[model samples]
Target: MSKTEAAARLAVRKTYKLYIGGAFPRSESGRSYPVTSSKGEFLANASKASRKDARDAVSAARKAFGGWSGATAYNRGQILYRIAEMLEGRRAQFVAELAEAGTKKAGDVVDAAIDRLVWYAGWSDKITSVAGAANPVAGPYFNISSPEPTGVVAVIAPDEPLLGLVSVIAPVIVTGNTCVVVASERAPLPSITLAEVLATSDLPGGVVNVLTGSVKEIAPWLAAHMDVNAVDLTGVADEDLAITCEQAAAENLKRVLRPAAADWYADPGLKRMTAFLETKTVWHPTGV
Candidate 1:
């Protein structure tokens, strides 16, 4: 076998693990599902994360939120750029996974996926300056408002696999917010592999966690999760499911982004950044 083929064979046998609190742990439920390669061949077992696993992922995100959000914009930008670099290095793996997933335009999807990461990486620092501004409230006091991270974010990744997953996740983390992502139901193996990329990309543990399982089973828990500050329904295709998730988010006044049927591979501009931000107001008395 060629060196590339040898590496591919070895990766196929690697047992995938869930990243929690910056460490790999077998699912608390001890469950796994079969992962397949591009050729309809079984590759490995992906962790079948349970409710307990979802909750654990949330806890990890919550714990890591402070440090991640508190990081300087420059540092966050660097980390995001690092992820793009890692993704570039592993382009072949993603291409292989996409082929296995049977995408009709695997080449286009791969290009879009890598391109999406780079787009978001550059936005890591610039978003704050663009979306966030010093608001001037008419008063004899110093008033300033700027955008801040919305705590922990829960996202339902797009079912298109490569473009879909990157579109949702890149925006969530670029602004210093951590996320618990549920991968596409039909094609989850790519999401699992992406998680591996993050694990090695210098991202803090829990800053971006991935879970592969039934969204019908886990998404509700996230919507109602008090610790989760926001919800992105970008992946919910069913109208009823979207409605139910919206209702759950309203429970805690969680920020919600309704799903849109956008062509994800097309240019996704500032919309993603504006969707997940919170405005924070700072006030002080001027006539002290």
Candidate 2:
């Protein structure tokens, strides 16, 4: 066989799909959209998620919340660190994806993303201690407050794609919240590939579901979902769209993280992690 023919035969194209309940499935609507590189070269068809897909993702997240939140914080930390290890092993693939999507600093972005995951992983067991407080009561009572997961969180991934995605998702899940993430519409291939990494990691199924499609089409559904306890709008750049989604989220008084320009490489602080957390205080009698 000719060299050119052999090379062509050796090339394998990948079809990107939505990750729901830890399984890669095509959009329930059977719709997909073309993904292209910065040079306008054809890449692949990415799943164009629909409202039903968003609903399904929420269901999956809700189902996984109990076990994930109830698991030992140390165990959750191990799983998150495992995800970082997996990402490091596949760094080459992520760099390629980011470069194809027009990111100039692909390698740096990949490295920063891996590092961000590690940072959040270390926070898993420490967040409670750092955020929790014990109060001195006027009476003979012990009062202590700690942070707890807010159940299902819906995340809208940012335009920066790789680094932005890692920044938002790591904080939410590290705190034991399950999430349904909407990957950046224009550059979702990397996020889908990240899903592949999560599937192989020690992380539990349905803990992190990813959808690749129009945020306009799916974000509203997730925002309004009764079972979704929080909404992260860090990725929605359109002002009108962001407001609409926030309004929908108010239907259930869901914890809403409004949209804002973020420097993904900078310190994320504890805001993102605390946004999806609820504080629970307990009181015990000292005279027991």
Candidate 3:
């Protein structure tokens, strides 16, 4: 076998761990399930994160929020571009995972994933200018409308493995929001690999965490977590599950992005940034 093929085979055996609070740890539940290729071939066993794990992820994200969200827009933009650089180096890995996940045209999935990252990287600097505004009122006081990141975000990444995952995650971090993401049920390997890539990128520890397991098993707990400022249920296709998430979110009035019925691959408009932004109106008076 070629050296590259042998290396890939060897790397596939390495047990994956959850990225929480900037450290790698086996699931607190100490459970793992067999991961299989889209062709039903055996891959590796992935850690199955439990409820306790979900709670811990929330804690980590909450702790990371202040510094991450408080960072200057220019710094945040640099960090996002750093992630894009890391992703470019790992294109082959993503391609392999998409192939195993049975995505048609694995190249297309990789290209789209890279393209999404590059697009988001560009948004990091300008989202503030694009989404935030200065307001004019009839009074003498100057009024400004600015956007701020919700404290902590929990995302159910797209089930498609690549595009779906990037769509939910890129926007969250671009605007300085930290996230705890639950990877796809049938396709967790790529998510875990992506976590490794992020770890190498300049992302602050706890800024982005990944869990691999049943979304049904983990998502409800996340939706109900009081510390989570918002929940994105974009990957949820089951109406019952979506409703359940919505009901749980009502506990705290957590900002939620419901499932999209249209094609996300289509050009995303302003909504992507607006959905996660909280408008803050500041007022100051000028006296003659």
Candidate 4:
């Protein structure tokens, strides 16, 4: 803007809030941290989620789990697809955020993220066909096993703000598990923006709660949280911190996915979705 244009109007800054239970709210601790761009330029202030915030997120996830998991797999797939459509509409915004966050091939990353969502959406209903099985028994019994969502999961997103976040989140939710996801600390703007998209989508509130803050401070609390059913340590780089979260998770026997070096651009298979799934087998008398 020119001098007169700049003088006439001031930019309205956006308040980057946490997405908990489908609403945007300030952190419970009332702390906000300056999120800087790739070159140390101020982007905006993101909520510095505290332990209390983490607990709230977990509660929200648990509350939504029953409804989300009970919904038909096809319904979940439709919601995920809707999210992808919304993200496509907001491509320019996501591209800008990724560029500011110093991601190379920003547009490509955004496209991959969108495609990843679509991929997982397609898998939602089909996963049962592939994972569920019928076993032949010598007796007159029909034995069948099927997969089910493991309940609320806590995810530490990888540092690739957009693609990595989508890569982890889509798999978890598409499989019917509600989740409390900690955005990548290095760059959370894109993740929060994605939360906005989610808010408008058909996805129910609390099905996917987003928290942006220090992973070290928030993750341990979630790991030890008795209500959380699983903890994904994909973004924890510190070995010691990962260990601490693992130990805490073990206390409740929460399903744990250890930190792994992942290529966000590569094809992510069924493993991520399977990690938090539990199998149930039933035996029925034939022709009873």
Per residue, candidate 1 scores C-alpha lDDT tens digits across 92-173 of 8888778888887787887788888888888877887787667677887787768888889999888888788888988888
**Stretch of 10 with least lDDT, candidate 3:** 3-12
lDDT of 4 by residue, 1-288 (tens): 566554556678888999999999999999999999999999899999989888899999999999999999999999999999999999999999899999989999999999999999999999988989998889999899999999999999999998999999998999899999999998988889999999999999999999999999989999999999999999999999999999999999999998469998787988999998999999989883
Candidate 4: where is the Cα deviation over 4 Å?
A: 1-8
Question: Which ten residues in a row are the worst by lDDT in model 2?
Answer: 1-10
Greater TM-score among 2 and 3 belongs to 2
lDDT of 1 at 22: 73
Q: Which stretches of model 2 miss by more than 4 angstroms?
A: 1-7
Q: Give a tens-digit lDDT track for model 3, residues 1-288.
A: 676554434443778788898888899889999989978998888889999999999999988999999888778877877877887799888888889888888878778777887788788778778777888888889888888898789999878888778778888988989999999889898888888888998899999999998899889999999999899998787889989999999999999998566465776666766778899999999698
Question: Model 2: which residue pairs collide?
Answer: none
Per-model RMSD to reference? 3.9, 1.6, 3.4, 1.7
* Residue 232 accuracy (lDDT) in model 3: 91
User: What lDDT score goes with residue 109 in model 4?
Assistant: 92
Question: Residue 245 CA error for candidate 3 (Å)?
Answer: 0.9
Regions of model 3 farther than 4 Å from truth: 1-12, 262-264
Question: What is the C-alpha local distance difference test score of each model?
Answer: 0.83, 0.93, 0.86, 0.93
Pairs that clash in candidate 1: 38-100
